[model samples]
Target: MKLASRIFFAYLLVSVICFSYPVSRFVRDVRMFFLESVEDALADHATLLANTVGTQMEANRFNAEDLYLAFDKTYSRPLAAQIYHFTKTGVDLRVYIADTSGKIIFDSQSRANIGADYSKWRDVYRTLDGKYGTRSTRKNPNDSTSSVLYVAAPILVHGKTAGVLTVAKPTTSINAFMEKEKPRILKLWYVSTGLAILLSFLVSLWLTHPIKRLTRYANDVRDGKRAGLPPMGRSELRDMGLALENMREALEGKKYVEQYVHTLTHEIKSPLSAIRGAAELLDEQMPAEKRSRFLSNIRTEANRIQDLVDRMLKLSELEAQKTLQNVEEVQLNSLINSVLESKGPILSCKGLRVTCEMDRDVVVQGDPFLLHQAISNIIQNSIDFSHCGGTIGISARIDEGMLLLGVEDEGPGIPDYCRDKVFDRFFSQPRPDTGKKSTGLGLNFVREVAVLHGGGIRLENLCGKGLHAVMTLPM
Candidate 1:
């Protein structure tokens, strides 16, 4: 299972285990608790009745007939007492008087047992022996709910024990109350369990969110995309993330330096060879025109080497940076116009006409200097590739919350084999006019700048005979 699932299930299991036992015990003991309360009330009634009966006996006016009449009246009276959830319609109290000999005298519930021997019954037997007594007996042998609780007190006449008065109440009403409340108790348990589950799920997601972000960052880096360190709160994970970022930079910096050194050396070799050959020739005696031609060749090769080194330095600086600095809002139209003006002499010399299709209000957020350099590099590439007297197109527009800036040149479009490598460092095609490759860092630098601005760059072959470079930036 996934980490979140594991966490959620683990938390839920613990919560359930912690909650199950106490709830079960409470549910199991509730009936007995109710019975105890009922028993206490019954004891009070028995004692009071015993005293009243003892007074009657002392006056020689003790009468079972009076008790029978009073109990009958109580049972017959209409009662609609609503006790929380249970309703009481009539009294369920029963009283029986037993003589000192443990023989029943008055049976309020039924007269059939008026003279029955009750010496074996705990309540009657103990009360007659001058001890406090109570007992519970089930009426129906197979039904536990049919149990009745009995409490007895000694009847004393003038401080002499005379008889026993016992009060009884059936547990049917208490059971009914329990039965009515069982579902509500279970419903509360269910609600508590559901809330626990929801809390577990939320906690798992909250704990794993930072890990997911860090994983995405690692994947992006593995894919060679520019990705920044993800935000992780003040925890051990944040410390680990910073450590990982530092390690990645250390490793990438080493690899970057090695690769650049190899490519730079290889690129400069050809120009160095040309300069060496030209210098050797100039050292020999030669005609003025030949000497001048050799000198120009040497200057051209030296300039080529210088240009290659300059471009490489710029690309290395850009690659080393993980984020942009000097952020500001840049007006696209104004920037593009400046790039075009900087290349005005070159455009005039090449006899190229530039057409711009863009709104004046287009703007984006980024480092102005980096934006200018990236755009200038793209325009310069187009200038080098375009045929003399050909037209170049520049356009900018906002689409889907992105600024799409495109530059197109009416030159031979990129070859199919070279298409994918156009944006690769030190990968370039021969310019259509010069029949020579550039330093090959221009498009790559443009791509880096786009990524720093939270955007991307792509090159596409125009229909029939041209190349288009599109840079997309968040607007």
Candidate 2:
């Protein structure tokens, strides 16, 4: 995966882990706090009902009918237990009244539970003994939901305790409410978690996309392709890209100016010498024929210098051009043939035989004029180095997505010591026949052309023979 994606996902995972525990704890606390509020409501209702029953028994008006009336009234409300009314739901709420002798007087919900002297049952027993009493349950016989709460108070007559009135209500509603709430709470958690995950995924993709673009742009720069950055909002990443681009332009500009000055001087030196020699001859008062010829030679050399300067400047300009809007795919074979046709007379005059072996329809995309000059320079160099009546061979092919263009000759090869410096600006080798002559900027210009096209060039001695110049370009 990409670096940006890796970082984003890592951050998402850490954030989720860090936040999840707190959210879970808060939900649990809220549930417990709410349940406690409901529990408190249930407890309060039980206390009020027990106190009302105890008051009636103290006035001696609490007979069996009074007890039944009390139950029916209590049963009308939530968590209430009126023994006679509970038969509709087939549930039982036990009520026991005990006399001062600890004798049971009334048991409504369960007949067997009455008159057995529940003076021993905790709620009745404790009230009879002049202590507070509350909810109690026997082990459930039929269901886990059978737990009950009991509230009891002392009955009095003539300012003395007579018996106990106990009220019981089953704790069924609270348990049922809890069951219903479980799924609802889980549904809420599910929705919240899904939204969290979705938001995380989108944010992760957005944050990382620009960084991925930056990595690819860096690779293009390393591969010597046209590389540029889009404006991204992130300050640090944008600064890094701008800095790299500035450094590359600064280095290229420094090297280009230095090379331009050296090649210009080298190119003009020959013409200057020719013009100076011609002027000296004109001073000697020579024959009209030779005088006119010398002057003509000066003009020809001046034109040669001018052509070299123009071609070199064009190559340099192409090197720095950010956009290749004029570029297109052209057949390499046809282009090479055109350059060969242009050099035909020169090769013929040198008594050189040209051998060509290029695949048909070998194509490359580039600026046509620049590509033409690069190939022309290499072929011309081969021709210049070949012996009279010797052979200059040109060939091209594709290897692993790269187009390989080569020129070879069967003349004396360049010495190994000078081979490394052959393509440096203004570093020329001596002409084989004419001693020290020939401009040195040709190979340097060819190298620049290769770089502009995201390609490369190298010169090496052909095996057991003359010079071999190779240019490799991406197809």
Candidate 3:
């Protein structure tokens, strides 16, 4: 998974864990509040009815006929209450009375419960003991909808408790409301969680975006491509990028200077020794031809030293470049023709034949100057190794959206043991004809150019022949 996604999910998980208990508690508290309101209303009804019955009993007017008549009378009522997403219509209330002796005196809804000993019931038992009384009972053990709530109050005669009046209500309606609210609350939680996750995802992306840019910049530097620090927003991340850039500049500068000093010192030693020896030999009295040969050797060694220094400087400049300064569409055929033209004199001197085979439309996207230099180096190597009157083959073709340039020469190929080291700095194979080695910066410089242009170079022995060099670059 991406870092952004991991961060988002981690944050979301924590948020959900933190909010879950609180949200659940809040919903539970709300439901309890509504149920408490229903219980309070029921309690009030019981108290009021008990007092009226007590007053009638005190005046000797309380009787079973009045109780029956009061409960049996038809009363039409209309109710339109919208409780959340549900509606309410009619009302149903149950009432029962019991004597102080625990015998049932009246039952409004069911005669089966009348004439039964009600003293053991919580509502009547507690009210008789002069305490607030309430109970819940299920009419059927297996049926949840059969649950009912009862609240009772004391009936007094001459300030003495005589009986208990109980008001009861079934919990079916309340359960219906709760059932509807369950899914609604769940839906609300789901929506809240989804929105929270989405917000976290966006926040994660915003926070990590700068890090991603910095990572890309680091990769470019590692690949030796010319790239600049990406713009990180005004945050600590921006400060970090700046610090890295400064560090890279300091370290690369120091390291580059140190490497150049070491390599230049090492390569100049042999040429300097040769020149010194030739100069010392020239001091002796010798034949004119012999003295003149020593002078030529001294001059040749000095010139070789100069060439080595120049090549080193050029390669250093190429290596230091992080990216190409000039990028253009380069026609492969044209570049090849230019290089061949430049090398025509050498080819003529060696009596070698050159063959060019190329697609007229073959093109690549790169620094044309760098491409030309790289191709020229390869051709020069081939020319140095080619036998007199042998053929040098140059070709360019398109392969899988890339341009492939090949140079082949009929000369002794690289030995198996040293093929891998051919592109190493200051490592060169001797020329086939002269048995002399040139400064070994050419192939290395070419390799650096190929990398800068997102291309590559490979040299290998051709089948039944000499060396073949191929350079591949993007089209």
Candidate 4:
């Protein structure tokens, strides 16, 4: 089966199972509940009628004529009342009376019931023995709907048991209500089930969409095409995409190393050529001032080469380590403070002011040395870019169970075109004051630290001025 269909069926099956059981049980229970309510109301009516009949039963004088007249009058009256979903046109209740000796005296529906021996009837017999009594019987053997309900109450005469009065109602009318309600309930259930299935289908599509994008991106990578990570919502699928991207990078590590070596060699050629040319010029006879200038040029070119190699080595070491070692709980506030204190002299010389908005106790679990170096590099970049008397901001807080550390500097912000490349290895923008670019490995190293600590770092231009670098680490 195809994926969409598989998910559709799986979701539908589970939803149907979950919905059908409770709905069916509820329908059945609802029918029974209505029936019980009817039975209770009939019980109360039967007792009240019996009490009225008992008052007319005097010593050796059964005023059965008046009782007969009452039932006759009651049955003759028309009932045009509408009771919710059903209508009442006439009395459906059958009232019967049996004496203490179990001899039937009156039956509302038939003449044959009068004077009939009804003592053995459960409703009559049980009520004669001072017990609450009821019974059900089918008028037809093969017709299940012919079932009738009977409720009986004792007739009391001068505080003595007199006879039994029974009231009966057929199930046919009650079944009519059940039959009518069944289809309506089923209709509602069908509508609900259809809606549920639709929602599940849409949810399935939503879930699989990201995986599809990831698959296409992987295929492009396999085809030797350059591709970046696909955008994804915040979910487990996003995490899986990240892991896949990391895996792809690891798999191409050899090619990446070769490319790095080629680029490093290409970049060092200019400085190396400058140094060698200065050395060659020094070998010839030259004025003292000219020789000294050449010597200074050689030293400056050599130092630039040394700085490039050192930065590359540090970045390479960071990239090679898959995980942080000897992790400890390092307080970010304290770490930033230490870095600032170490660079206090430089800040003062540049007439720069640095302020911190951080609690003393905000901490993270990471390699303290790496985290310290990452923050130091960020601060150094801000210090380098900032103009004289510029203000640098450092702040820390906890967000969504992660530590958020932000560093801001008031300087000429990065250009829009260079924002995306800020964290790229060996890509640097010239500083505003000196118009000189350092080896662009600082932000990249910070990014590696973030990845190792299961976190992330982002550098963006602040609104209306400067740049802001924020690092987030899991708590």
Candidate 5:
């Protein structure tokens, strides 16, 4: 009816089927095994008694009182308590001597049944005809059903067949004993089976929880959320998690590169145009001082363009590499300090308040150089856009083994439409409000770093206002 119930019933059904088969087989085998063992014991006892009776028959002769007396003395000897069923039950177990004509002359229980013809009974008939004979039956006359083991051997005097010695034991007691043992054995089997099923269920739950978490995290990532990957154990699930993380990294890298290229080209277009126009102006006759200034401007623009191009190419190469060559544990707080130190001159000149809000022990696995470049680019972008005394916040935290790096600025936030293209290489503008132009390669470089680290980066408006750059990397 319901999923949980269905699963429970399914498990129960399979367990019952699997458990029932072997247990049923074992029960049957147990019954038969015990039956055979008792039969062997009875046969051995019967053989020994038969020999004693034969000796008595030889000494006491064929007379009724003498044979009966011999049977009495033979059974009187100490033997296994299992041999006596007559005193314990209504059924009689006894020895009998019959002649070659199949006429019984002596019986331990009664002589009345002796003169009665036993030619129809297999044991007496076969013994008279020189063959081994055995049969099982109830000893009581009124009781038609019985389980008694009987064996007959021919008595020999001077190498000639004289009479038959029939030895028997009633097995009602043994049967009852086996019946008593059945419930306990079944109970033991059931207890063990229940424990096994419970253990399997526990193990299944332990295995399924991580997979479910991974599934949810994957879906969130697909929907463009900053969903963190779960911590994984050293098992098959861990391997699967690692593989998914790797795939995410590749997709993120490709996406970052695509955006970076578009922006880089856009930003350089303005500088290239300015340089081209300036070069054209120089071709026309002009004052040497102005011409020299024009040449200097051209060289400066060319150098600026060259630097941007080199950085972009290098970032692209890093993104293309699926696996980082130099991987090590990098501290987020410490790395942030390093980037701030590198930009110390600009921070001082711009009067930018760069605040690092990093957890003391935040760590991630990635290339230190690439990480440095990515974070540096983000901070540099903030510096370029910020007004005097503008605040820049660089913060890092870890969520389920995924490092979340945030770079925020108090500068004017990105426009809605342009937000999507900001990561593209060369895609920058002279902020109409700030009247400042950017190389645009900064965001693109940050994007490549995200890809190379098997992670992703996004630009969003911080809580109320201001721009926020959030980068996610596997820790």
Candidate 6:
């Protein structure tokens, strides 16, 4: 099972076990507790009644008829006693007296039992032998609820035991109370258990929430997405997440260095070979014009290598950054205007008519230097590929809380086969004018910049003749 499930079940099991025992015990022993209370009350009543009978006997005025009349009056009186959830309309007490010989005399419940031998009963037998006594007996053998408790006290005349006065109360009311309370107790148990389970589930989710976020972040990183580390609070898990991030950076840095070295070696080989051949040719006899051409070729190849190295270094710096620094609000119109002015000479030489179609106040938050470079690179690509005297469209607008800056050039659009690889490092298409490919890091750098600004870049073919590039950034 999952960690949350395991934790939930473990918590629930403990809670249920802890709650079950006491509740179950209380439910089981509730009748006994009630019976004990009733027995104590009956004992007091028996003792008091026995003392009253002893006083009357000492005065030689003890009469069974007087006692019977008093009990009859008590039984007939109307009562409406409300005790918590129980109601009492009449008393369910029975009283009987046995002589010194252990034969019954006054029997409140039935006069027919007055002359019966009660010596065999525990209450009578034990009380007649000068002992405190009590007994519980079921009136119906098959019905446990029909049980009655009897408590006996001795009647004393002149400090001598005379007879046993016994008070009996049926447990039907205690049974009634238990029957009424069992369901309520069970309900409380159920509610408590349900709340415990709910609490357990919430706790499990709370405990595992950070782990889930971290897991998702790890997965995104594994899939090579630019996913940031999730917040994990000040716990061991946060430390672990940071550790994982550090480890990933370390491993990726190693691979990055190795890949860059290999690519740089391969890219510089052509320029190095050209420079070597040109240097070798300088030692041979040749026409001045041819010699000058060879020297220019050597300079051009060296400049190409330098440009490639510079772009690669800048792209490497961009790729290493997880977040942006030097962020500020940049006016897109002014920035684009600046780039166009810087490329004025080239635009004039190529006879490209540049059209700026955007609001003057469009702004976005990002690293200004990086955004400037990204825009310049994109426009440069357009300038490189556009047919002479073709139009270059530049537009910027806010749409759906994003700043969409588009550049459309009347140049040959991207080929279907190269569409997916356009933004890849060192991937480039040949310029229509020069029929020469660039360092190929410009678009990739633009992509990194867009991503760092929490945005993206995309290029599409504009109808039948041009390429449209759109860079979207959060406004």
Give each model's whole-structure lDDT: 0.91, 0.74, 0.87, 0.86, 0.76, 0.92
Query: Considering TM-score, where higher is better, how would the candidates rank from best to worst?
Result: 1, 6, 3, 5, 2, 4
In candidate 6, the residue pairs with backbone N, CA or C atoms under 3 Å apart (3 or more residues apart, or in different chains) clash, namely none
For model 5, how does the per-residue alpha-carbon lDDT over 104-212 read when each residue is reduced to its tens digit? 8777877688687777788889877888878877668676436677788777766677777787777676666656677877897789679757855765566567877
Q: Give the per-residue lDDT of model 4 (tens digit) for 113-232.
A: 888998888888999999988888899989988988899999999998888999999877788888888898899889989988997899789778888899998997796444678899
Output the number of the TM-score-best candidate: 1
User: In angstroms, how far off is 262's CA in candidate 1?
Assistant: 1.1
**lDDT, candidate 2, 30-65, per-residue tens:** 656754554455446545654655667566555686
Least accurate 10 contiguous residues by lDDT in model 1: 15-24
Per-model TM-score, in order, reads: 0.90, 0.65, 0.77, 0.54, 0.67, 0.86
Instruction: Tell me how far the alpha carbon of residue 73 in candidate 2 is from the true structure, in angstroms, after superposition.
Output: 21
Ranking by lDDT: 6, 1, 3, 4, 5, 2
Clashing pairs in 3: 226-322, 226-323
lDDT of 1 at 14: 85
- Model 6 reaches what TM-score against the true structure? 0.86
Show where candidate 5 strays beyond 4 Å: 1-60, 66-93, 101-103, 110-112, 138-146, 157-162, 172-281, 323-334, 355-366, 394-405, 432-439, 447-456, 462-464, 471-475
lDDT of 4: 0.86
lDDT of candidate 1 over 364-414, digit per residue (tens): 899999999999999999999999999999998889999899999998988
Q: Over 4 Å off in model 2, which ranges? A: 1-10, 33-255, 351-358, 433-437
* Residue lDDT tens for model 6, 1-475: 9999999999999999999999999887887788888999999999999999999999999999998998899888899999899998997799999998889999887899978998999998899888878999999999999999999999999999999999999998998888899899999999999999999999999999999999998997886667788899999999999999999999999999998998888878878999999999999999999999999999999999999989998988888777786899998888988999999999999999998889888878889999999999999999999999999999888889998899999888999999999998788888877778888889999998998888999999988889999999999
Give the better candidate number (3 or 4) by lDDT: 3
When 1 and 2 are scored with TM-score, the better candidate is 1
Q: Which candidate is the best by lDDT?
A: 6
Off by over 4 Å in 4: 59-61, 256-475
